[model samples]
Target: MRHAGQRPADMPGAAGFRAAKWHTPIGTSRPSSRVLPSPARVRGPGPAARADRAQGPDRGASVTDLATMSLQQEIARDLQVSASFDAQEEIERRVAFLAGQLTSTGLRSLVLGISGGVDSLTAGRLCQLAVERVRAAGREAEFFAMRLPYGDQADEKDAQQALEFIRPDRVLTVDVKPASDAALQAALAGGTEFRDAHHQDFVHGNIKARQRMIAQYAVAGAHEGLVVGTDHAAEAVSGFFTKFGDGAADVVPLTGLTKRRVRAVAQALGAPSALVLKTPTADLETLNPGRPDEDALGVTYDDIDDFLEGKAVGEAAFEAIARRYRLTEHKRRPPIAP
Candidate 1:
């Protein structure tokens, strides 16, 4: 007779099969072999076992896809665009109402950092509108645009374009080469080595950004005006800015809008097409040139914003962003105490 949990030695389909060893709580023993069911009967067959079948393949998207995806995901998912229209209108109305607030607060002028990009251009134009409103209310309000170049000649071109576009009451260009060089020398003296030209380029870029902030604050103080920030919600959420550098401001005019929305609004306001379409760069260079902002960040601003808005940015995209921004996170927020 067969024992418990043991099959018969001459079981069916066991003529050519060898006995297999079995381990139980009692002891180890060999049991008669049994034929196993086919894989299709056990696990079933439906989809192919391929990476693309399981997780979808990403062969890189087109520019239109990238732009549309970013905007749609951020507005629809994170901000809930349908429910946000009223809130957005209210924010615009409040911005218009700031004319009265400025008057009451004894502020007469607005100082803006005109980077010639969509954000800065939008902020400059919006400030111009607010200044007009304030002036209409019998209050003196002026818009001062400063083009502070850290030695990049290409940036000077963009800055000049912005200056021509805005026609601010006062346009000043301050070269921050001396300050940037001093900072670079100090940083390198601390044993921080540059792996290549790109690394050195980034260090110089950070200097340029900080120098521009210093110049903006100085101009704002001199003119006794509120320093307007050009930072938008997308950059804020992903921490894509310099902390006390470009991130510092008295008031951020475009803080509620994403970078994509900023471009839309800028286009709506009739900003220069060339300036609006230009790839953003920190404009830090004394000699050759540097890579664009997207190149340094590994991912585009649109992609970063989309991920922040709760869209599936994919593991590869996320890793690219993490690798880039993780190292520069300190530039995005206030220094924490150890």
Candidate 2:
């Protein structure tokens, strides 16, 4: 059988769908987003060097053959060949799929936090389409986009643009600062302060994420809705989310897609270009506004995309990505128990 990454020339795509190209998106992380910068660059073997190493001094395999095999292995292990997928068709399918999942649960509404980021915007549009599909089926459906700002968000403009584009059934802005402050106060009760000043951003950021979840669930329960999440393959592969925070959700519509692919979906779904092309940011840190996700992850999204696509990357990046995948394996799984 052909591997999933292998697409025959005659392979048929989904009805009314055709494969397309990949578009790179910027990656940024906040102190609270838990992303660290990608590993620094280091001198690594070029294609010729890798081919020589693979052939070892005795093998007769051509360098081209070795390189092709290496690329295939990498794609099999990491990348998904996202460009082979049709964005328009996938978005429609996800809309229907989410609708079906919600209908099966006897829930007719969806709730999500909109961060004005591409992931959230794309997922928000999906939610709107899902709800529309459900309603078209003669079932009652609603989509709620909640803006959970910590206080005054510098990037609130982006969030507003997304809200305008999505135009969900309802728009609610809930400042999470009060709740975050309460949680921090409770945690710090009987203690004078945290160990360090900078540590507060981390603690507060986690609080903000969890608080957003709390708000989403509350709204969902009130409206008999399922919580929607925006987690996707790129973030998942790198374990770039917080457990029980943004990670906790009733359903995720954007999983199984790389960050670049997610942007394509956003564009296909009519997401505003400004929103689709907006540099990614976590908006988790209050003091340090606009902290790029790459700065924390120590790697650029381009490299991450390349690594995921099985393209040759620097040695340091390859090792760093591998190490992160291994370390974050636990994040991708359910809690262990005997």
Candidate 3:
């Protein structure tokens, strides 16, 4: 079967979704209100170097694959992608963690952006659950779900469904297209020019991502809440997030989860099965709207999950994913010191 990276959304996507970083909307930690967001490909090297991973000098296949496999296991340990865990236990652990943060910091609320995608949908619901626990302990806490759309989102109905399930204490909608356009114009008016429309769209998409975060932070500032990010192991592995855009947040609840594992938690929380398994995308590109993230990475989410779970994927997919982890290390780290 074709993976999410190669298949259209109307068709069934990959059997598994990797929790990718916020590159686009979906790769931004498998991303908000939705599935994984993708990163803009322009800022770094384009696609994976297919030629690099070819049979390692006639070495046995297992030996040739050792480095890649080792890296995968290293990351898996870091992210805690266990071979097994009860979904309910996962939910309880995460909720307690959120509540603990609230009690310790004295923050009264948790805020998240609802993308109507599985990532955001799941995160939003978790926020609601956490805050509810805090309140039950005689503390005053609340969860606010923001709808930061860029004029219109492709999966708005799905976003609404996520809201219905989350039932957050507050819902706010802010149209980001206006602010995003203004920023793009201001950047161009500085005598900067793009080589093409694709480049222009890439810049515009990143601007939109930052703008969405700005709105979320603003709302969080106003409400005395911490911004909750949807970051998880799958997205983190790919570094698919938009650095300081979807990547910046006060709290990230979904760390160490695979895409399917995130789905498992959402299912336990009673999210509709269909929504939990919706096609994952960053949908960040205006040039190719609603594009599957797999297309951008030149591999599928299944490839990512397989790699993360220590299962073998095709050489092409394996190399592409490993290359992303190496190239995007900067995205996952702090600035260099003097």
Error of 2 at 185 (Å): 1.3
Please tell me which predicted candidate would have the highest lDDT against the true structure. Answer: 3
Task: Name the better of 1 and 3 by TM-score.
Answer: 3
Summarize candidate 1's per-residue lDDT along 67-145 as a digit string, tens digits.
4344334333332222243434634653574465467768878887776676787777777777888888787988888
Per-model TM against the reference: 0.65, 0.76, 0.82
| lDDT at residue 294 of model 2 (Cα atoms) | 57
RMSD (Å) per prediction: 21.7, 12.8, 8.9
Which has the better lDDT: candidate 2, or candidate 3? 3
lDDT of 2 at 123: 88
Clash counts per candidate, in order, are: 0, 14, 43
lDDT of all predictions: 0.53, 0.63, 0.68
Span of 10 residues, lowest total lDDT, candidate 1 = 1-10
Which 10 consecutive positions of candidate 3 have the poorest summed lDDT?
1-10
* 1-338: candidate 2 lDDT, tens digit per residue: 00011011112221111111111111111112233333322122321111012221212222233443353344324323454568988887788878987788888789989888898888898989889988888999999999888888777798899998888999988898999899888878957475465556555776677788889989999999888877666675555665567767777777557778889998888889988888776657566567555554545666666666656655555544555554454444444457
After superposing candidate 3, which stretches have Cα over 4 Å from the reference? 1-46, 49-65
| Lowest-sum lDDT 10-residue window in model 2 | 1-10
